[model samples]
Target: MSELSPYEIAFLSGGPTRVAQTALLALYESDRIRVSRGTHRVEVLPREPEDLHPVQAAVIDQVPGTGRLLGAVLEAVAAAPEVRAVADALVSGGLLRAGLRGALRPTGEGKALRRGFETSPGEGDVLRLAALGPEGVQDAKMREILSTDDPKPVKMPKKPKGGHRDLDSSGLSDTQYSAGL
Candidate 1:
């Protein structure tokens, strides 16, 4: 298989939330971008002959005041500058396309990506491993298997027979899923 581009990795790893979750990580994955981390904030530093997508670079350029770091930006609301910029970048950069006229009009690319993230095993390995964080992997073997920036192949520890995903919280079956939708 061919290698994943940084943008592709970010989209498959999660989505807008995943990109937002580690803005710096996602941004810095591209050779054109660098991150300057302060005690409480970060700056999105761009390199000359920028290798980033036009949309991504443009959004980074518009991020105000050295970009307010990763943590704060991730926790910020939709209207916040960074969140707004990232959302725009996601669509313009082709990770997600614009929806139709309505407020909830789903875009074609967005729907396909969402389905892959939720249902494609080949695509969801990193996502599931990410969900099962370091704390979730109590065993050294699992931890060793999961610790990597770009995992080429992964051998996930088999789920227990009873279907409890982890010990931290009660695992919910399909019927028990929240929101009662």
Candidate 2:
């Protein structure tokens, strides 16, 4: 296989969300976007570079003119079609397994690619690696952004298995129940 691009490496490493984050970080590193340290607000700059990766452009599109919270922007861009296209390409290229909904398993080639990249990362791999997690990031602010910007969905606590005792059909548990009135 030909040498894979950093974006592709990111997809292999952590799927579409990583691709979105790589694009976002690339935009920030390139000065295409501005991030507010105080509020974690992300805004696209007026100056548009003629050449931008599809995911990068999509990330910019995800942001509003008034800017948006960093976490929300990351979530929006991760779900964008452009990011999905990267996954599709990987699947078609025999990297990622097809038909997996929740957790995408990588094919042999994908695993080897990830392993190779991890073992001997090139200079270009820095941003993509950083996008995977905060460990690879050097800048304190960027690391903070990487570590805190993406918010995971909260898992709601499960309801009690037997249902509420207060609403039991026997009526003994009911508030108005009078045992021997």
lDDT of each: 0.42, 0.74
As a whole number from 0 to 100, the lDDT of residue 143 in candidate 1 is: 39
Model 2 residue 41 lDDT score? 85
Q: Candidate 2 on 37-137: residue-level lDDT in tens?
A: 76788999989467888888898888989998888887888888887887778787889886556566789888887887667665643453533445566
TM-score each candidate.
Answer: 0.34, 0.74
Q: What is the TM-score (0 to 1) of candidate 2?
A: 0.74
What is the Cα-based lDDT of residue 19 in candidate 1?
Answer: 38
What is the C-alpha lDDT profile of model 1 across 1-181, one tens digit per residue? Answer: 1343333434444443443433333354453334332233345564666465533544465457555543344444223454445455555655555446522222566555555544542322233332323223343433342232322333344457866445334443455555565
- Model 1: how far residue 87 lies from native, Å: 8.5
Candidate 2 Cα errors over 4 Å, as ranges: 99-103, 124-132, 149-181
Off by over 4 Å in 1: 1-24, 31-40, 63-67, 71-102, 105-113, 121-181
